[model samples]
Structures are given as C-alpha cells and as structure tokens.
Target: MIGFGLRLTLRGGREAAVRLVVTAAAVALGVGLILVTLAGINGVDAQNARYAWLNSGVTDATSPTAEPSPDPLWGMLGADIHDGARITRVDVAATGPRSPVPPGIPRLPGPGQYYASPALGALLDSVPAAELGARYPGRRVGTIGAAALPSPDSMIIIVGRTAEELARTPGAAKITSIATRSPGDCTGCRFGLNADVLGLILAVTSAALLFPMLIFIGTATRLSAARREQRFAAMRLVGATPRQVSVVSAVESTVAAAAGTVAGFGLFLLLRIPLADVPFTGEPFAPGDLSLTPVDVLLVAVGVPLAAAVAARIALRRVRISPLGVSRRITPRPPRAYRLIPLVLGVGELAYFVGRRPDTTNGQILAYISGILLMMAGLLIAGPWLTMAGSRIMARRARRPVTLIAARRLADDPRAGFRAVSGLVLALFVTSTAVGVMTTMIAERGVPDAGPAARGTLMVDLSRGEAERGAPEASGAPVPDRVLAGLRSAPGVRGVTVIHTNPLGTMVPVGRWHMEAGLVACEQFAGMPGFGRCAPGAVAASVPPHFGAFDTSASSAWSRTVWPAAAISAERLRDLPAQGVLVRTDGSRQAIERTRTALAAAFPDPRWPPTTVAEAGADAENARILAGFQQLAGVVTVVSLCIAGCSLAVSVVAGLNDRKRAFSLLRLAGVELGTLRRVVVLESTVPLLIAAVVAAGSGFLAARLFLEAQLQYALRPPGAGYYVMVGAGLAVSLGVIASTLPLLRRVTGPETARNE
Candidate 1:
C-alpha cells in the first residue's frame, strides 16, 4: 500500500509535479529561517560565556581580611573614552610568583608593560599617542587572544601596575582565581542583559519569526487541495481504504518536506559567515559561536518532515470521512461572531493591567506576556471573520462583475482567503509594537544636544578617589599649580575656573538667599552661560552643586533661584586647594580634542578622564542598548515580511491551480482575461489592507499600554519609520500577489476546460 501511494505521487503528471516542487521550496525556506534564529540564540550564550571570566572577582569569603594574601593578585578595572568609544582598561599587579593568569594573555606583565587586543592595537596605531596612548604609558608586550574578547571588534587592554598603584585606585579588587561566575557585589564586572531577560528576548524573537514560517509551510502542503481531494475520493470509490489514502497523502507530503529540510540546512551553512557580520548587539558575532549542536541538528532534520506529514494527513480528513461530500463541493459552515471573543478578552486583559502602576514582579510580567500572546492568537482566530465582513461589504457595493465575483469567492470560503494574509497581519503587529516602544525610549533616554557654551566646557574632577566612590564632598587633594598651568597653557584654552567645595553644612550668601554651594573663581564664572554672573568687584562666587553641568529645566525651583544671583569676594577661599576644574575651549571640535588630549597627558589616571558637561548627564549606554534593539527589530521585520510574501505568493498560485477548471469555463463563456485578473487583485487586496490596519492598530495600542504599565511613560506616536515600514510591507505583499497574476491566463487556457 505504501509502494502504491509512492507510485501514485511520483506519476501524477505535471500538476502533481508542480505541487511537489512548490511544497519543497516553501519548506526549505521555512526550515532555513528557523535554523538561523536558533543559531543566533546559541551564539549569544557562547559570547557571554567567553566574557564571564573577566567579570569574575573574589568575594568576602575568598578575601576575608584587608591584608593582601601572598598568592593573590590585585586588579582594577576602568574605562577610557576616546572619540566616544569606550576602551576597557584592566590594571593588574601580581602579589606573588603564584598569582593566577587571565584567559587571553600569556603571563602577568611587570610594571610598565601591557597587552592589547588586536582591535585595540590597530586603533592605537591609527591614532596619535597624545589622544589615547598617553594615558596607557606602557610598553606593548603581546596581543590578547580571542578567548578573552567578546567579539573581533572589542577594544581591551590589560596593563601591569604596582601594588601601591592599584591600592590607590578606587574600586580595585583582589582575585585569587579567574572563574566564569562573579560574586554578588561585583556590579562593575557584569555586562549586558541578565540571563532571564536575554532568554525572554530570544523567545520573543523566535515566536515573531516562527509563526509566519509555519503558515507558509501549511499553505504549501495544501496546494491544489481540490484536485488532491477529488483524486483521493476516486480512490475511495474503488477498493482503497481510508487508511491507505491517508498513508499516500502523508508519504507524498513527507517526500517534499524531507528534501526541503536537507536543502535548508545547506542554505544555513552557506549564509552563516555573512550572518556573523550582522551587528545585532553592537558587535558582530563569531562564526563558531553560531554553530548548531547535535541535538539542534537532529530536531530540525526530523521535526519538519513529521510536521508536514501531520498537516497533510489533517488536510485529507474530509476525504477519509466523507469523500462523496467533497466530490459534491459542499461548502463548510461560515465562521461565527464568537471568534472575536478571544480578541476582546485579550485587549481587556491588557487594558486592565495598563490602567494601574504594576511592579515588575514575576506574576505581573507573566500577565503582561500572557496578554500579548492572547492578542496574537486572537488575531489569527478573528482574521477569517474580519475578512468575511469586508468581503460582504464589497459585495453590497459591487458595481462590476469582477468585484461581485471576488467578494462571493471570499465570502464562500473566508478562512482560506484569510489564511493568505494572516501571517502578514501578525508580522505587522509585532513590528509596529516594537517600533513604537523603541522609538519612544530612544527619544526619552537619548543624550540631549549641548548648547554652545556647554559644548566647549570640559569638567575635570581633580578629586583623587573621592569622586569615583561617590563620597559626599567628592573632594581630595587639590589641583597642583603645575597641572593647572599646563591646562591653561594648552591649545584652544579660553579660560579655567578652579572649583572648591564648601565644607558640609556651611551656607554662603547668593542674592538674598544663602545656600550651600561649590565656590568657583568669580572672574571665570562670568564667561560661562547658564551659571549666574558674579557681582562687580567680586573675587569668588557660590555656584550650585554640580554647577557647570547644572540641569537646564526651567520649571525646577533650584534653577529659578540659582542663576543670575549675587556673588561674594572672599580672599580666604581663593587660595584654597581646588577639588575640580572647569576648562573652557574655543567651541570647536579640534579645540575640544586638543584640550582633551592635553588633560589626558597631564592626568594619566583613566578613571577620572576629562568629561564634557553633556557626557556627565547623557545616558550613552542606554542609547547603545536602544540602537541594538532597533537593529534587532529591523532584522525581525525584514525576515517576517519576506516570509509573508512567500506565503501570499504560494497561496495565490495554489488558489489558481485549484480553480483552473472554473476559470477555464468562465473564459469560454465570454469572461475577459482582464476581468478575471481584476477579480484576483480585489480578492487579495481587500483582506490584506483591512488586516494590516487592524494589526497595526492593535500593535500600537499594546505598545502604549505596555509603556504606561511598565515605565509610566506618556503616550507618543511612533516615528516616521513605523509608517514607512507598514506602507512598504503592504506594497511588497500586493506586488507578490500580482506576480502570480501572469500564471492565471496559463491555468485558465482553452485546453484547461476539457475534462481529465
């Protein structure tokens, strides 16, 4: 019986051969996409593992006393910003001969030596020594290995320093051994998203891509369903049992699915190298990081074919039960309005949560995710009813035979019509929600543009280790005369204001109000904007805390009372040591760079690098994170749209094949080819446009609700890219459906009218 089924599937002529080919191609694409997504998830884990050792440090259990252990190493990690790129600096000093070595380097370097990653080496070679290399002040030893670097583009430097140097540095730690896990209090060692968040993101990404693939494969397997049903019915009428017919259908579908699965694996291998170059997380992946495990390979190899066989078996249920009914072309019952209940309930669930301020407890998070999943499932369930309603409206307003014919066809089998556009609906929904949330976040958290005065002002915290530790005064040894002289004499130096913090609880007079504020040289304060000007003959001024980089919010009571106030000339404070300095430049990029270089050369410590007023307040890390999310969203949108296009094309071709006989009869009876083509266009266009609008609306609403609940962010419209993405997606789907129109004339030719 199995051999008989195989023979029938193999020798079923041109139409059967076309079906086989279409099914295979569709399955290949679907399988390939799934494999790629899995590879990316695996790669992220691998990259994280490689970085864990660097983040690990000894806890209180390992280092109980302040006294240095004989065999332990003292390590200090800091960052240096050059051209807006962060270069990670790891300073280490061996306490004994037995100190353990880190992963990438050959050995612990002595004082005045350092090892640079390949990328950092290239960058150091490209730029001048004053700008970056001056801060390192060490002889280059060897290159760090790939095992220690997160990506090929990562910039890292391991510098050797004395034990006294590390002890003087803030946030330094003792490490007995290098390990994959860090202690609980080791905050600086952690990088990127936590494990749970990363898992959630990967799961969401998989779902976003997986559903469309499933739809495409299902549509492929059901191609030419009418003809296949008729053939199966004829077999049932003869000696063939229901079980035999089911085996034949499954075998036929499995053959194509198995072939496609193998081809998809080959396609994945071909694309892996290029895919590694995609900067999904600000850094491109390593090719080996994306390699699939044996279990992953086995799953894709067997799972896709089994799923195809099951879908094929289910599609033939009618033939197995009531073959005579299928031959008579009996229509199934129309979908009821109840299909919309799930959609309403899902929206209500989200609305209920959105109305309140919910904490990020596990229950609340689960509820939010549940609401989103329900809405997604509801969209699929409610699609047929919505398509049916739209078709009915078109039928009522029909002025041409094409409109009436298309509407009737859609109304008769709305599920089949809706299936073609369902994947598209989901894709638009997911992409719209992602775009809405990310756009709002980028706008709110992005760095604000500095005004002209602020742009030229560089704030250097001269406080030794106090500023890094966030001490109350942020005060330390005063700026030496030589350091101040070098800064003033630096190129593009316009002015320098020496800052001195007033002792805690001391109030200084500024206008009628007396407040505790930092004291700055009155002569220099007059030149800086936003800070109030000093009174005439005043030698010093009492400026607000964080004076130079003060918040510019007009509504703030602090800003209202602080700026444009009185000043006092106190000679005693003028001669006091300076805890910080405000260096003003000529408001040019070159001037800023030159001034920064001079400061770097003077202050060799990387922890307290010169910072612009803008950098002090700006959330640069958050901006980078948002950019990564935007890149990921783009990849998801593109992949989903492509799969949706394929699903639309496959469905159109299959519909044409299934109705070729009917179309042929219409042509012979005087229906023009142009009119038939218009009917196809209207049928695809109405459902597509209607579903797209619903999906987009639902997506935006969900995003807004999520933001309100999670972050309490006010409602704001998504950026222009959202609209452009929707427009482009719709245009591409219509174009794909139209591409199948040329096949219409061929399928409905005069010869097609003849009985088989």
Candidate 2:
C-alpha cells in the first residue's frame, strides 16, 4: 500500500512541479524565519546579558591578568587602602560654556572637582607642579566617609611619584565613590510574560511562518486531490473501501511530507551560517551555538515529520468521501468558527484575569493576549464581508469595462480574493508594527532641559584641596562674574539663588533589593520659552532608576525593588525638609540655611535667571540614540512596503492566468485588443485603489493610536509621516501594474491560446 501510495504521490506531484517548487520555497522561507527568530532571541538576550554583567558585576571580567590601569575621569582601577590618609570629598564649580540663559534658574555645576589626601594637597603647592599651575581649582572641601582612603582614591594622591611610578605601582591612590546606579532585578520582570522583546520576535516569526505554511499546504493538498480524482473514482468502482482509499491517500501525503521535511531540514542546515549574519537576527546561532540537545534533534528530525504527518492526515479527510465524491474542494466559509472560538476563549480568560489581578503585569499580559487574538478573529470575520462589499461597491460604479469584469470576478470568488489579499494584510501588520515602535521612540525626542547657571558654584576638589581664584576672564572673554552681573541687571533676571552641587551616593532598600540612590540638586524651573516651563525644588527622574532589572542572568529574586523615587525635577514637597544636614560640614540645619543665604546674597552677579535653569541633562548622545531608532523603523517600513507591492503584482498576474478563458471569450465577442488591455488595467487598478484606501486608513489609525498617549501633555500631534508612507506604497503598486500592461496584452493573443 505504501509503495503504491508513494508512486501515486510522485505521479500527482509531477503534474504540479511548478507549484510544488513554489510550495517548497515558501516552506523553506517559513522554516528559515523560525531559525532566524530563535537566533535573534538568543542574540538580544546575549547583548542584554553583557550589559547586565557590566552594570551589575555579576560576572567577573575575563582578563584579570592585565595590568590595572588608572582612569583620568574615574581614577585608578586597582589600588590598595592606606591608613590615616586624611581624605576629603569636594565639589567643583568650573566656568560653563557661553550660551544664552533660558527662562529658568541655571543647572548646578556638574561634578569636576579634584579631591586629595592632605599629604597630596601640600605636595601640589610645593611641586615643580607649581610652575605649571598644578594648584587645586575649587573651594576647601573635607572628608566624609570613615574608612581610610583607598590608594586609588583621588583624595589619597601619592605625592613624590613620577608618571611611571604611578603606572608600575599596584596600589596607587584610589577614589572610593559609590555609583548611584541600581543593579538589575530578575525577580521583578518588568513586563512579565508580555515581554516586549519576546513578543516582538514572536509576532514577526509567527507571521513569517503562518503565511507560507498555510499557502504551501493549501496549494499542495488541492493539486494532489485534484489530480487523483479520476484514479480514486476507479478504485471506488472496483469496490475499494473508502477507508482503504483514505489510507492510501494518507500514505501519499506522508511521502510528500517526507520529501518536504528532508528539504526543509537540509535548507536549515545549509543556511545556518549566513543566517547568523542577517540583520536583526531574531535569535542568534553562533557556529558552535547550533546547540541541539538529543531531545531537540529528535524533535527536529522525528518531530517535523510527525507535524507534517498531522497536516497530511488532516488534509486526507477531503479525499475520504469515496473516490466518486462530486466535489473536489471544500466550499469556503465565513470562518465564523475561527471568530467565535477566540471570542469565547478570550472573554473567559479576560474575565478571570481581571478578577484575579487587575493592574499587575499579569493583567497587562492577559489584556495584550486577548486583544491580539480578538484582533485576529475580528479580521477573519470581517474579511469576507469586506471583500463582498468592496466587490459590489466597485462593480456598481466601475466606469471601465475591465473594472466591471474584475469586480464581478472578485464578487464571485471572495475566497480567492481574501487569500490573495492576505499577503497585503500581513505586510500592513508588519509595517504598522515597525512604525508604531519607531514613532513611539521618536516622540520621546525633545530639547533637553538646560539647568540653572553655576557662576558661583563653589567648586571644590578634595583630591587636591588647593583653592584658586576664578579665571572668568581667562580666554580673552569677559569675566563670568561680570557677565553674571550684566545678565542680572538685564530684564528677566529674578531672585538670585546660589545652588551647590555635591555628588552624593546613597544606599536604598526597596522590597528585597538593595540599590544605589544617585542625587542631584538644583532649584526647579519657574518658566520657559516655546516648549514648556519648569521650577526650583522640582526633580525629574527616569522611569526606572536602574534599567538593570530586565536581566534574567543574575538573581532569581521574585520581584524588583523600587528605589530612590525622585523625578529629574519634581517639586520638593512640603513633607520633606527643605534643607538637610550637610554631609561633612559641622553645622545645624538653620546654620546651613544661614550660610546658603549669605552666599546667595554675596554672589548676586552670578545668579542664573529662570531662563537658563533646565531640569534635565541635555546631552547630544540622547538625541543620537533617538534618531537611530526612528531611522531603523523607516527603513523596515519601506522594505516591507516594497515587498508587499511585489507580492500584489504576483497575485494580479496569477489571477489573470486564472481568468484567461473569460478574457478570450470577451475577445471573441468583439472586444478590441486595446479595449481588452484597458480592461486588464482597470481590473488591477480597482483592487489596488481599494487596498490602498484601506491601507491608508489603517496606517493613519495606527499612528493615532501610537501617538495619543504621548500627546496628552504636549500640543501638536506627531506629524503625519504615515500618510506619506501610504502614498509611496500606492505609487509603487500602481507603477508595477502599469509597467506589466504591455506583457499582459500578449497573453490574450493567438500564440497564448496554442500554449494553453
């Protein structure tokens, strides 16, 4: 039976060689996507792992044998501690770049002070260093922590050492500044099972897999079943049992499955190398990283065949209705069951989810899952209705004869219409997804807040406790103090406040996690220009203090601990004290206020007006990152749109092939050659315009959904880039159709009839 089945399958496939090849290519593409997806997940995970390792020190460096080096900015990497080293922490106030003061208080000076041990301070004054002006450039600063300063501490600077000695010494002065950054928390997975990165990979992979898999299976089964119609009828006439014939059919399908399985697995192995280098690798497989466990290999080798067998078994049902069955194909339904099952499942699951955990990650995951599934169901249910409605609408108003014929053809076969257009739907889903993410990121871009001025920031470097007078006029420019006075005397300058910035790292305990608390101090914004405004005592914070919690390679803790809750410029609330005890200074809170007030009064000329005070660090790197994100989205959308256009062209040509007889009959009825060509163009154009209209509407809706949340605080809607993108997509599709018109004319000629 199996041998006979194999022979029959091979014979059947011979008649559909072109189709089989196309199906194989589709299957191969699907399988390749699966591999690529797995690889991408691995790559993203690996990258996140590296970042987490670097941030959390969960993994030790691989090259510990290399000589420890000193960092000019961060100080020595490896250094010993020294006893009785009178080390101190200091703040620095350097003259800032020349720029217009905006409408708010200027930012507190950034940390740039030099710190030192008492012994090093005395050496800086006595050195040949004095000849090159090696004196400390900030206010007198004192020590804070009790532990004797580490050798690498800038405050514990070694005096009588040459540059060579500094490099050779294993235990040089070390700076002991605790980082304010928090570590990753594995316990608190940010998005839970709705992992954004994972979901993104899954969406892309599933789309790639489903389309090709369905198309391959559908075409393969139809061709096989159609060819065997007569043979199966003969078997039935000979009194062969329906079950026997069904078994034989299953066997034939098994043969096809085997061939396809072999082809797919072979392709997987062949492309494994180049797949590694593909852009946006879903999950990466390094050369040796093609790690398949015994179980995995068994699954791949044996499992793939079983999956194919199942598909074949299901398909064999169509062949079961006695070889003499009248209909060779299943009539297309509205997919009501597809729509209903998900709706029922989604409703139940959603109800349970909301009742159990309404606002948690679990709830969010359930919501996302239900919404996406419902969307799929809705699309299926709506597809037939839309196709029928579109067909009628076009046929009613179609002015061109070709348009009328195309519309009637579509109305007669909504099933084929739906299937062919499914490619467009897939393309839109991907394009919209890419756009949504890209736009989400782009909307985040903005002018960084410039903080209050620091004309009298009282810069102090504890590492080299030698204070010097200001060089405000050093570079042939007006003295900064003088400039400050001039600005204060100008129109917009308000209350003069002298703010001090001292980099302080605090320890925070949230839930089960221990995290570092980084603090920056400045008066908040009171007003601003075209953008928006801000005030003193207001602090703004990043969404999460530590971006580290997303790493799964570290702790197995059950939840992330929230820590150091403060915005970049959140207003200092009434409950919190306005002033706290200074770190190393010996003074009461009142005394501290007194000192601050005195300084503010003395430095009236250096006061940064409200215009210059920005709450956030306005760095160039942030802008660059945002730009890169938006650019990537644009590229993906353009590529997908182009692919979609090509796919549409192929479908149009295929439909034309299916309709050749109809076209010939019209020609025989005296349709002119030019009129026939015009009809062909009209047919393709109606559908293209319909698709374009729907696509444009969908893209607009997608953009609105994406930007709505971000625009709550801002005024302008994000500009309509998607409109331009949709227009581009339409133009490309129309261009391809128009270009193919001449070739289409030849298909209706006498030579074409002989070939057919």
- Candidate with top lDDT is 1
| Model 2: how far residue 106 lies from native, Å | 48
Quote the positional error of residue 396 for candidate 2 in Å. 2.0
Best by TM-score: 1
The parts of candidate 1 lying over 4 Å away from their true place are: 8-11, 58-70, 182-189, 355-365, 449-456, 462-464, 467-478, 503-517, 526-544, 547-562, 570-573, 576-579, 586-594, 601-605
Worst 10 residues of 1 by lDDT: 551-560
Per-prediction TM-score: 0.90, 0.52
Tens-digit lDDT track for model 1 on 404-455?
9999999999998998898898898888888888777766776555555565
Candidate 2 lDDT over 1-756, as tens digits, reads 667766665665544454345444444444444444454444444333322211111113212342322322111221111121222222212122331111111322233333344445554455343211132234324321212221112233211223343343332323222221212234321111212534364454455335435444544444434335557767777887777777676675555555666676677678667644432322222343333345544555565445555654564464466555634544445333344454345334434443344465545544544544453444444555566677889899988777787777667766556544444554555456456645555445533322122211111111111111222211111113443354334333333221212123345443367555323232221211111122333352112122222221222231232223344333332122111111111223222222333323332211110111111122223454355445545544654564455455555555555556556666667887777676666555655555545544444343443334223222233357766776677777777767767765665666555554
- Runs of candidate 2 with Cα error greater than 4 angstroms are 1-15, 45-358, 445-666, 669-688, 695-756
Give the clashing residue pairs of candidate 1, or none.
Answer: none
